[model samples]
Target: MSYTVALFRSILFWIAFFVMSSISSIGGVIALPISHRGTIFFVRIWAQAHRIFCRFLLGQTIVVEGEMPDIPVLYVFKHESAFETVEQPMLFKHPAVFAKEELFSIPVWGQAARFYGLIPVDRDGGGKAMRAMLGAAKAALAAGRPLVLFAEGTRVPHGEAPQLRPGFAGMYRLLGIPVIPVAVNSGLAFPPRRWVKWPGTITYRIGETIPAGLPREEAEARVRVAINALNPPEALLESN
Candidate 1:
């Protein structure tokens, strides 16, 4: 698609997405004081609706290449852009995400995130912060909710493979559950640091699950390879 047309569609999608987010945030806020489940229910609907808008308006559709586990597992996703983050709640049932603490500071959205059982990670804080995050994660695991995490910690541009962050290893050893590593090419369709949304399919390839009980370094290595399976092998070598 031409840049002009892509730009227009991207703008329209963003406007609709944010408007829906605001409306959903209101619903989440109202349900927050009453029922946490009700808040999550509204949020999931919002995420699905956003996907629909992207499908019809921006000509983008998500194609899942592998099956998502029926039971709760630690999900380590390749963070290429906001696309997966927007689709996450819709993809899993009542998933507990480890999002940056700063995201939980947003007005109504922040409050709703906390009530929805989203764990906050204080990146710059020391051991205390990690402990607090792990504590929250354990609670989520006990509740049987899938833990969604970005192994790279933040968005890495398309085609770049970064080493898995230190926290991922910590969680793997502590959580002691199967880890599902997901790779996505969302950045190609919805490129980061740009407004133009390309008309293409955003592929999410779920690699084989890595079982728990491995040493921290070994587990991290396996996850890094799994989540970057879609990337070139040279990229993986360079990242290491």
Candidate 2:
């Protein structure tokens, strides 16, 4: 698609997104007082609507490889763009995603996210923050919700692979659960911080599950490699 056409489509999609999110956020907050499940219904609706808008408005398609585990485990994803962030709700069944603490402070949306069981991480809060995150994670697991984390800490540009943030190993070690690493090329189609999105397929490549209890170094090494599998060869070389 031409740049102008793509830009137009992207603008339309964002307008729709804003309207949908506003309604969903309000609905989620109102539903929280009634029932937790009611809030989730709105969340799912918002996510599903975005998926539809992506396909029809932006001509973007999402494709996933490898089976998604049915059991609750730590799902580590390659963070490239906001696309995957929106995709998480539809991809996982009631996952408790680890999000930056700031996101949990976003008024109505933040309240709904907390109610939806997202764990907030304070990057500079040190041990106290880690302990709080772990407690929240444990509670989510006890409630049968799978843990979802973007181990890179922040979104890296497409094709660049960075080491997993320190907190990932800490969470893995303390949680004592298997890890499933997911790699996606969402940035190719949905570039971060950009208004124009191209029409293409975003692929999610699910790596083999790494069992829990491995030494921290070994586990992080394995995850780092797995989550970068989809990155271009030159990008991998650059990171190395």
Candidate 3:
């Protein structure tokens, strides 16, 4: 598609996305008082609606390279764009995603996110923050929810593979659960901090599960490699 056409489509998609998100957030907040399940129901509907918009309006298709697990485990994904952030509900069943603390401060959206089971991460909060996050994660697991974390901490440009953040290893050591590393090329189609998106295939490559209880160094090494599997060879080399 030409730049002009793609830009037009992106605008329309974003408008629809904004409307869907507003309705979903309000609905989730309203439903939270009655039942937590109702909040999740709204989130799943929002995710599915976003997928529909991407497919039909934006002409973008998502392809999963490996089978998604049914059990509850820590899912560490390559953070490339907002695509994967919003795709969680559609990709996993009632996932408790780890998001930046600032996101949990948004007014209506934050309330909905908390009700929907998104764990907040304070990057500079040290041990106290870690304890809080672990507590939330444990509760989510106890409730039979899969944990989703972006090990890179934040979104990176396409083809760039950064080292996993310290919190990941902390969670792995404390939680004692297997980790599933997911690599996605979403930034190719949905660039970060941009107004326009291109029509193309976005691939999610699920890597082998890294069992818990390994030495911190060994676990981080394995996750780093697995999450960057879809990145270009040069990008991995540069990261090293």
For this target, which candidate reaches the highest lDDT against the unseen true structure?
3
Look at candidate 1 and tell me the lDDT of residue 34: 90
Error of 2 at 84 (Å): 0.6
lDDT of 2: 0.90
The root-mean-square deviation over C-alpha atoms between each candidate and the true structure, in angstroms, is 1.2, 0.9, 1.0
Model 3: how far residue 50 lies from native, Å: 0.7
lDDT of 1 by residue, 165-200 (tens): 888988888878899989988888888877778889
The TM-score obtained by model 3 is 0.97
| Cα RMSD for predicted model 1 | 1.2
Model 2, span 116-219: residue lDDT tens: 88899999998888889999999988887889999999988888988889899999999999999999888899998888898999999999999999999999
Q: Model 3 over residues 154-223: C-alpha lDDT tens digits?
A: 8899999888888898899899999999988899899999989999999999999998889999999888
On lDDT, who's better, 1 or 3? Answer: 3
RMSD of 3: 1.0
